[model samples]
Target: MILQALVDYYQRLLERRTEGLAPFGYSPEKISYEILLSADGGVVQVNDIRDNTGKKPQPRLMNVPQPEKRTVGIKSNFLWDKTSYVLGISATSKRADKEHAAFKSLHQEHLAGTQDAGLKALLAFLEAWTPARFAAPHFSEDMLDANLVFRLDGERTYLHERPAAQALRAQLLASQAEGQPPLAICLVTGEPLPAARLHPAIKGVSGAQSSGASIVSFNQESFASYGKSQGDNAPVSERAAFAYTAVLNHLLRRGEHNRQRLQIGDTSIVFWAEAADAQEAERAELLLADLLDDRPTDEQEAARIRSELEKVQKGRPLADIDPRLQEDTRMYVLGLAPNAARIAIRFWEVGTLGLFARRLAEHAADFHLDPRPWKTAPSAYRVVLATAPQYKDSASMDDAASQLVGELVRAVLTGRPYPRSLLANALMRMRSDGHVSGLRVAICKGILARERRLGINSDKEEIPVSLDKASTHPGYRLGRLFAVLEAVQRLALGKQINATIRDRYYGAASATPALVFPVLLRNAQNHLARLRKDKPAAAAGLEMDIREIVGGLADNFPRSLRIEDQGRFAIGYYHQQQSRFRQEDGADSGNTESTEDHIEETQA
Candidate 1:
């Protein structure tokens, strides 16, 4: 199914002939220099073509002839190759002499009888030129290993772009079917054609080999079934292989300001939309990219994104926002991860564009909280990173965090119960760090609220976005009590203490409340007394607040809490803490630094 869809998309690109897209048997390769040659094969000047607009000189991507799928063997590409093949000099290659010989011989055989000036000159140059000429004043040491192409000295076009060279390329492609694999039924196209012995390389995965990696490969005898070897086991045709790989590369490649790509943890994702109408498909893609990728800086584009997001958040169809998107337009999202020399399928989902937009809408609603933790609606990318250790890179997350990232993303896309591991990771991080920021608490509340709405392994009451001054659940009330105790400590003493009670006892107070709360309560009495002598009004208000929260609970604290209760505890603490700060912030409305979100941690 994946391959068929990819092949169909490739056909769409072919028919459209999208600008800058490479055609069949051709690919966009990075070429650094152009070796200008005279009509008699004498070296003229080596021209640098690398772009210098950025901080460093980057090679320019040019559409050249399809390169060979080289392994450890010595194979040369047509019309273009690196200095090791073109000039027999490289910074690291030890067999430059043999590679240069192979390049010269290959070009000689292909261009022997050509009558065109460009082709004849190129053949003459390859036949007489030696690598020793690289030491000339016109050549520099930095160009020793960079890829180079050929061009006539006085012309404004490359030699490979000449009519004779194009004809030769077409002829070579037509004659490539000799000594092919046996004909078999192609799995991707359902055609009786020659099954490719090897598939093309797929690049752009985060940790894969820079050269490329394979999606379908059978390198070991043990991996084959019933004596079938390599591509014979899968039976994908060469045409199908090229089509699918081409589509993948096109989607994976990044332009100057591309947003179609997103990475979460170790997984690299590419998404697209298709519809009966090509413009509608492009519109859907732009909307999806705006929703999941980086925000645009242009004022008009930003306003459009905001309008679309507002519609989704209100439980309205995304189609209603912009030109009324078609309900039947399809959306495809595929994620790739690296596995040695092969690529692993982390996730793939296909659905209607409207359906995906609605899924994103639900995600926005699920993450909602009182006192928003972020200026923009949080994406699945941020949610996954919240589970990783603070200051650590997402691409190198631990095994559990990496596994949870994919599952949580699937949950958001499919409206599943949000893998129980999500809540577990949130709570675990809170306990380990002794820091319950508003963001983590919002995540906890989101998990508990969404799971209850779905009726999954939960019989708990609805967790509210703000503080509940009248709840009887022990976990909720205890969380409130813990926040109150910490507040008392902060108020009696200023905010300059070395470590507050939260830094000392949050984990134990949440898990084994029976053992920890009694001591906290005793300490709170001393603080209340000290406050009563100095600030009578504030002390009385705090005492009543403590009495009211404790009155909701029964006589004693529970010995321990279940997983759900732990999440509720975090939510309750966040709510009470934020509610307290909001009151203080209101008193000093003119001061922007009155809020306590920054003092907690970066999680906010």
Candidate 2:
């Protein structure tokens, strides 16, 4: 399915006449130098074509004849290769002499009897070039091992781009095909064609080999079966192999700010939309990127995404939001991770654009809070970051985060209950750190809410998005009472103290209220007495709110709270604090909505 989908997309690009895409029988490669040759066979210059916009010199990618996949033997590319093959010199190669010979030999045979001026010039240059040319300072040391292409001294286009060279490419392919036996039925295209012995290299996956790595290969003896070897084990056609790799590498292009690609933890992902209209396909691609990543946005883009999300929340179909949108458009996401000598398929998903739009909207709703914690939608990366240690803020982590990110994205896209570990991890972070941000509380609520909707915990009451004053749940009331006690300490002490009861006892109070609350209450009374003398009205308000919360606890806190209730406890505490902050001057305002003013003043 993966390979077939890629082949189909490659055909789509060709049909659209997409620029910068490599044609069949060729692949896009990073070319760092162009050897300008005179008509007779002498070096004019080794021009550096690398882009210097970034911190380093980055190679420019170009379409060239597909290079040979060499291991230990000396094989040559059609018209371009690294210095070791093209110039017989290298930074590290023991067989530079043999490699240079292979390059010259291949060109000598292929360019024989050529009438094109450009082809003759390239062949003459190869005939006269040698590794010893480096001794006379013919080119810069930086160009020693860099991949190089050829062009006539006065021409702007490379030799491979000349009309005669292209014609020769077609003729050579025909000759090779007529004499070869049918290898097998292509697994990707289902056509009887030549089988690829070694698949093309896939680049741009982070942490993979710099030269590139394979996705389909039988490298070990144990990997083969039924007397088949290498690529015969899977039988992907050479054409299909080239097409898929070309499209994938195009999607994975770096330094172009490719919208179709995003990195989540250690998983490198690429996504695209298949639509009849190219513009419509691009619209869907950009929208999905906004959904998963925190891409830079201006006022207009942010407002547009919000408007679209509002329609989805109101149960409007995608076509209704944008008449040109094809709700049935197919969307594909592929994630890759690095293995030893090959790439691993971390995850692959195919669905309709409408389905994913609805699911992502549902994802936002599940995690929503009354006093929303974020200006933009909370990214999956932020939700997962609540679990990681505090210092690592790169939105990436070790291998464990990679696994969790895959599971998290799958749940959001499929409308399933979030993984149980997600809730546990957030709760554990709150317990240990004692700094419960609105983001962490929101994630806990989302996990529990999804479980209830999916009937995993159907017996439990529906968790409200805000404070539920009438509820009699023990954990809820205890959480509220803890907030009140902490508030009283802040009132009595103001900014004179370095720590409060919250910093000391939040973990114990949430987990085992029975053991922690009685001690907290006794100390709260002394603080209340002091406040009652200095500010009687404030003390009365705290006393009234405290009585209301304690009355529901049956005058006795539970010995221990369940894990589900612990999540509710965090939500309850967050809600009460937010509500108190919503009031004018800490006095009751009869509103649940709060702003950042109170949060900045007290939470810090």
Candidate 3:
């Protein structure tokens, strides 16, 4: 299904020239250097094609013919290859004579008897080529690794771009037609076509080899069954294999202003749609990418996102926003991760374009929380990072983080319940870090709310978006009490203390409150006494708040809390803390007004 969808999308891209998709029998490959040659085989120059603006070389893409299969033995391509083609340098360990003999023979077979000037010049250059003379002054050690393209008589156009090169390529393929793979029923196309012995390597996946990695491969004899070998087990046709691989490589290509791929943890995610209208597909892809981006480039894009989200929320038909998008256009999102020499499929989803947009909007609504100073709707990456241990690098997250991210994205797309581990991990971080961030709180609330709506935990009270003073959950009231105690300490110390009660006892209070709250209340009384001396009214107000929270609890603090209750505890604490900040700001403003009135009376 994945391969067929890719092939369909590839056909759509091919029909539109504006997409810059490579045509059949060719692909966009990065060529780092060009090898210049004269008609008489003299070395003219070696030009570096890499951009110098960045630390690493930025090679531009060239529409070269598909590269031939290279192995340990010496094999020559028709017009373009590495240093072996232009500088007569062989990459194999065979005897120097044998290597040069093979290179000369392959070039003579392809370029001989051709009337084109470029082909004749190229043949002449190869006939006179020798390793010793070629390596004297023009060839350098670094040039050996760079990809080389030939030029005849210092012409501005590359040899591969000349008219004769295409003819030679067609001739070469036609002669080798008898050597093609055996016919088999293609699983992707459901037709009898030549089966690919080996699928092309896939690149742009994070953590994969720089050269590339394979999605389907079988190397060991034990793994093969019923005499099938390599890609024969899957039975994908060569054309279908090329189509799928080409579309994926185009999606993964970098250096573009707006990329179609995103790296989340160890996974490389790519999204596309099979729409009749190419512009509609492009616009939908861009919208999805912008919505999932953690840090959007600017506020204007954010505002645009909000506007589109509102349209989705109102049940607006997709065609109403853009007439090009029909209701049934298929969309695909694939997530891949590196696994040794192969690629692992993390998640795959296929649905209609309208359903995808609606589900994505639902995901945004799920993450919505009270207005946060940091961000309105946190991205999937930020939500995953919230579960990491404090002061630790996110790159060091264990396998659990990778699993959580994959499952989270799947849930958003399919409208399924988030992984149970998500709630557990978020609470674990909050306990260990002694703090709950805005992102973490939002995740907890989203998970718990969904669990309630699904009837998974129907008996428990629904967790609100903010602090609910009227609720009577023991864990929640305890969290509120803890917040009040911390506020008292902050007010008494003028917010300058090195550490407060939260830093020392948050984990203990949330997990084993029965053992910690008795001692905390005693400390809070002393803090209140100090505040009463300087600011009696402020102390009284804090005392009443603490009493109201404790009064709601019917019994002593529970010895321990369940995982669901722990989430409520974190949300309760976060809400209470934010409320305290609001109250403090109001108090400061009232004090300023009172002082202004006193100054006016003194002046009168």
lDDT of 1 by residue, 1-604 (tens): 8888888988887788865457777777889999888999878988899999989999998888878989899999999999999888898999999999999888888898889888888888887877777785778898978999999889988988888888888888767755676689999989998777888888888889999998999999988999898999999988888888877887888664555677777788888777776788788888888777534567687677777787877877665777657867888888888999999987788998788778877777777777666545655656755665553222225533775666767777787778777788878877876657656776787787788788875565678776788677788888888988988988888766788888898989888999999999999899899888988887898898899998888887899988888888887887777777878766432222213344432231
> Clashes in model 3: which pairs?
none
Superposed Cα RMSD, model 1: 2.9
RMSD of each: 2.9, 3.4, 6.5
Clashes of 3: 0
Query: Against the hidden reference, what TM-scores do the models get?
Result: 0.93, 0.91, 0.88
* Candidate 2 per-residue C-alpha lDDT over 1-604 given as tens digits, one digit per residue, 9 for 90 to 100: 9999999999999899887688987888889999888899788777889989889998888899888787777788888999988888888998888998988998899899999998898888877776667764458778877899998988899999988898888777677666655668999988888888788998888889987898998989899999888988899987899899999898888754679998876678899999988999998887777777754457787777667766876668877777877788899988888887899887788998888888988888898887766656656666676666443222235523556676788788889888889888877767876767777788788998888888988546777887899877777778888888988998998888688877788889889988999999999999999999988998999999998888877856799999888888888888888877766446444323344322421221
For candidate 2, the C-alpha RMSD (Å) to the true structure equals: 3.4
Clashes of each: 0, 0, 0
lDDT of each: 0.79, 0.81, 0.74
Candidate 3, after superposition: displacement of residue 485 in Å? 1.7
Range of the 10 consecutive residues with the lowest summed lDDT in candidate 3: 595-604
Query: What is the overall TM-score of model 1 with all chains considered together?
Result: 0.93
- The candidate with the higher TM-score, 1 or 2, is 1
Candidate 3: residue 214 lDDT (0-100):
80
Q: How many clashing pairs does model 2 include?
A: 0
